[model samples]
Target: MSQPTVPPLPQIFNFLQLAAQNPTQYGGNAADAPELTRILQEIRDLSIPNGAQHSAQGLEPYQSIARANNPTWNARPDLRPKISKFRIVKHTHWGKAYWSPVDLLGLFFSRLEPAPLGATVRTFFLPMTALFGRWAFQLVGHYAGMQSCMWKIQDNGPAQFFLGASIVGYDADIPTCGNWRRVIQKARYSLLPNESLFLRDWSFANSPHGPIHPKDDYPLGNCAELYPYLHLLRGVDESNKNVYGIALKKKGVRSPSYNDTLQGSVWQNVQWPCVKCRELIHIQEGVLANFAPYAGSKGAPP
Candidate 1:
C-alpha cells in the first residue's frame, strides 16, 4: 500500500499550537491526525539512553577529527569479501529529501534510550571514544542518505563518515528485523585481541575473533572500511555531540600529536604497537585488509 499522505508540517504545527493553547478547541491533534499525531506523542514519550549522551574527549575524539578535518578529503572503498551480499542503493529509491531532516531527527531522538539495531547500535556504542570525525555528514541536508559504515576496531574505534547521497523521503515502517538480519549476515567478524587482519581469505574473514582495520584511504573494502557508513541513520551524529564533548574535557584526550604540526585530514591516522610483540605496524586501512597468517605469507608470487 502507498504511504498515506503526511499533512504539511505547517498545518500539523498549527494544529499542535492550537491544541497547546486550549487543548479543547480540536480535542487535540492526535484524534484529528492519528499518524502524524502519533509521531508527536512518541517524541513526548521518548527518553534518552543512559550514557548515550555523555561527552568526554576520551569517549569521542572523532568529533575533534571532524572539527579539525574534512570527511570528504580522502574517502576510499572496501574490497574484501570480494562479493557483496549487500548493495548500496541511492536514498532516492527509498524516499524523498522532503522528509529527511525531521525523520532523521525523530529517529535520533526515538532511539536515544535503547538504540535501534544495526547502525543505531554501532553509532551509540562509540560514546566519545572515536578517533575519526566520520559522523559529520549527519548535518547535511536531506539529499543524502545515511550510510552506516562498519569498522573493525583495534583498541579504539571512531565514527564512520558518510557519502553525499540525498534523502528524498522517509519510512515509518523501518525494517528493523530485516535490516538487523542483513547487517549480521554480511558482517565481518573482528580480529582477536591484538590480532588484526586484512582478511584476504573468506574462511578467516567470517570469524568474529579478529581485529578489523580500514582497507585504504579511498574506496573502503568492507562496510567497516567505508567512512560514509556514518550517515546511515540521520540523528546518529548529533547524539554524540553532547556526550563526546563532556568526555573530551573530562578525560583530556589532547595529545601533542592531536595538535601536531602535520597539516592534513588523516592525522588521526595512527598506528599502534602490537600488544603481543610490540611491532609497530602501519595501521592504515590497507594493513587491516592485507593481514596474512604469518609475516611473509602475504602477496606471494602466484
Candidate 2:
C-alpha cells in the first residue's frame, strides 16, 4: 500500500478557516493543533533555492530573520549568522551599531521573491515577527546608559595584563568589585602610581566559558581592578606593544553579570614581549573563592 500524501498549505489554511468559524462544532485545542502542525510543515517545506539571491553573504542575515519569524526552522546548523553580509549599515545607512530585529527582517524580506504565502503561514510570520521585535527591544533596554557591552580597551603590560590566567566556576563565591579593585590598585601602584587596566568584571558575563568563540580566558576580577590596569597600560605606552579590545562577562551569575578581565588595544607602535611568562598571572584555573587571594597577587604572579 502506498503512503498517504500530505496536502499543501492551502488545504491547511482552508481547514483552519472552518475550524475557527465553528470551534464548538469541531474540537477546541485538538482542532487547532493540526493547523499548527500544517503551518510548521509548510514552513519547513519552503526552501531557499540553491544559489538563491541571499541578502546576507554567509547566511546570518538570511538565517536570523527567517528563524525569528519561524522558530522551528534553521537554514544551516553548523554556521554563525553573518550579520555583516546584510550590509544594513552600508545599504540602509541606519547608523546604529546593531540592527533592530525588525530591521533585520525588513532587510531579509526585501531581498526575497514576493511569492504569496499560504494564509496561515503569512499570519504566523507577520505577528510572530512583531513579537520577536518586541522581545529584542526589551532585552536591549538594559543597555541604555552603556552603549555597548563592557569592552577591553588595551592589554598594555604592567597596568594592563591578561586575566586569562584564571577560571572561576559558578559554584564559588566572589568578592565585590570594590574589593578586587583595591587589591589590583595596590599591586599596580606598588609598581607605579598611574596605571590602566582591564578587569574581568568588565569582560565576560561570568559564564565560566566563552560562547560563539571557543576560547578559555578571563580578563579581570571586578570593575575596581579597571583603573590601575588602564593606568599601567597607559604608563608603559612607550615600551609596550599590543592593542585589541576584548569584551567579556562573568562566569556564573544570572544577571547584572560579572567580568573576567579587561581587554584593550596595544600601543600603536610598541612591541610586546613574546617571551613574557604566560604563567596565568591575574586569572587562572581556580575556584571563585581563590580570586580574592589573587587580588594583590604580589608574592606570586597568577
Candidate 3:
C-alpha cells in the first residue's frame, strides 16, 4: 500500500479561500481572531511572480528576506539560504582590540536569502514573513544603536589574547559604545571615514572593559583602523515597509508570535545554534519582552 499524499498548497489555498469567505461556517469569526485576519490580509496583498530565472546560486530562505543561513535548518534542503556576514568591533576587558565577523541572520530571529522567491512560495508565505521582517528591521536598528550582541568563539586568557579571551557566553553587559556621537557633535576628534555616530552609550569609554584606543582630541582619520565597532543599522528599507504593511501593523505585532522561533521538525536537528547564538537569542527575547508595545513577553508570568 502507498503512503497518503499531503494536499498541495494550491489545494490548501482553496481551503483558506473558503475559510476566509465564510468563517462562521467553520465556527470562527475573523473579527475575533487576529491571526486569521492577518493571514487573510496577507493573502489579499500577495504578489504574483511572473516566472523563475536561473541563477549561478540557487537559494531559498526559510522566511522571506533573511539573507543569512539558518544553522537550524540543515535537514531541509528547501531552505538552504546563504549566510550574510556583518562585522563588529570589540575591545576585550584585557585591552586588546579585534574585529569579529558575525553571521548577520544568526544574530536575530531571521534568515537571509538571494532575491525573488518562487511564485507559489512567495504567494503563500510572504505575508507570514512580516513576523520576521518586522522584528528583523527593528532588531537591526537596535544592533546599530548604542548596545548590541557580541559573541566570543574562543576563550579569554593571556594565552588566547585576541584569539578570544572570554567564556563563549559571558554576557558583556558592559557598554560597547560610549560617546563618539557627542565627540563628533563637538568636533572633539576628527572622525574616520564612515564614523558618523557611535553605537554605544556614554559609559562605554570608561567601562572596565578596555576602551582606551580611541583618542579624545585627535585626527582618527589617520588611525581609522583602531576602533573595532561600527555603526551598522540605519533604518527600515522600502521592501520591508511593503512586506510588513498588512501582517504586523497592530499592537499584537510587537509581541512575539508562535512563528518567532523555529517550529516543527527544524528543532529536531542537532546543528542548533552555538552558545553565542543562543545568548543573542536570549537578548532578543528580553528586548521584545521589555520593549515590545504590548508591554510584556510571552515568557512573562500570566
Candidate 4:
C-alpha cells in the first residue's frame, strides 16, 4: 500500500498569499480558479472524516478533547460509552482556521439546548446542536447568498474593517446566545467615529428557555438560518454616502437567479440582504427627499 501524499508547504503558502492579497478574487474570481478550487477541495477531503463508518477508526483524540472541554460530558456517565464513540470533525482545511473541540461544543450549546440521550440509542444519534452548528459554520460556504465586503476609510484614512454576520441563533433571554445583539451594539458605536459595521442578518425570535419576545423595532437584527456564505469584497466604504448608495444599488438591481431563490436567497434577502446598505439607503433617501424640492427655493437650510 502507498502512503497518501499531502499538499506541499509551498503550495499552501502560495494559496495563503493569494487569499490575503485579493481576498475576494482568490475564491470568487481568481485567474487560477480551477487550480485553487481543486486545492481547497483536496484539503477539505483530507481533513474531514466520513460518517460513522469511519467514526471509530481514528476519533479517540477528538472525542477526548471534546470531553475535556465539555464540563457536562461526565454528567451522563451512562452515555459515556456512546459519547466516546461519537466522532466530530470540526476543523476547517482553510489556513489555521481549525476549531478546537471546545469551540465546537460551545457552538453546539449556542444553538441548542442540551438533552439527555438515553444509552439505548445514543450511539445511533449525534446531538442536534452539534450537527446544526457544524452545518452553519462549516457547510454554509458551499452555497451562494450574501457577500461579505470590507470598507476602507475614504481619502486614504487608516481605518478598514469588516461587518461580520453569521447564521447563529439569537435569544434575548439566553445570555450565551446574545452575541448577535452585542455585535449590533458594537456596530452602532462604530458609527460615531464615521465608520460602519453591518452584518447580513440576525435572528429575532422568542427565547426557547424563557418567555422573551424578539424586538420588532430592531429589524436589522434578524437573519435567516439558511443563508449562503458570500465571498468577501475589498475596497468599499460603508460610511461614505455616495459609496454606500452605489453598493446598495448594485446589490438591489442584480437579479437573483431562480436557483438562488430556491436555495434560500429569499430568506437571505428578506428585508435587505445587507443591513448596512439598507441603513445607508434610508439616510440617503431622507436627505434627498428633504432637499430635492428646496433646489429652487431661496435660502434653504444649506
Evaluate all candidate structures by whole-model CA lDDT and list the values in order: 0.24, 0.23, 0.23, 0.26
RMSD values for the candidates in order, in angstroms, are 21.8, 24.4, 21.3, 18.0
| Candidate 1 off by > 4 Å | 1-137, 140-175, 179-181, 184-258, 261-302
Q: Pick the lDDT winner.
A: 4
Report the Cα lDDT for residue 115, model 2: 16
| Candidate 2 RMSD to the real structure | 24.4
> What's the lDDT of the predicted structure labeled candidate 1?
0.24
Give me the displacement of residue 239 in model 3, in angstroms. Answer: 40
Q: Per TM-score, what order, best first? A: 4, 1, 3, 2
* Structural RMSD, model 3: 21.3
- Model 3, 130: alpha-carbon shift in Å? 23
Local error of candidate 2 at residue 201 (angstroms) = 32
Worst 10 residues of 1 by lDDT: 243-252
Off by over 4 Å in 4: 1-14, 17-68, 76-141, 150-153, 157-165, 168-302
lDDT of model 2, residue 92: 23
* Candidate 1 residue-wise lDDT, 1-302, digit = tens: 11112234445445443444443343322333333343333322221111111122332221111011122222312321232222222112122211123232333222222222332211332221222112112222122222221222222333332222112222111221112222222221221212233343222233232433332111112222122222232222333222110011111122222222122211222222122111111222123222221221123222
What are the models' TM-scores?
A: 0.19, 0.16, 0.19, 0.27
Tens digits of per-residue lDDT for model 2, 1-302: 01112234355335444544444443234444443343323222222221122233444323212211122123432232321112221112222111222222222221121212331211222222222222222322211110101012233311211211111111111121112222222232232221222332222322223221322222222222232133223443433333221211221111222122221111111121111111111232212222222222222211
Residue-level lDDT tens digits of model 3 in 1-302: 01112234345346555665655554445453443443433322221121111011232211111122233344443432321221122312122222111112111111111112231111322223233222323322211101122111122211100000111111111122122223232221222222222432213233222243444321221111112111111132221111110112222223333222223111111021222222222322312121122221123222
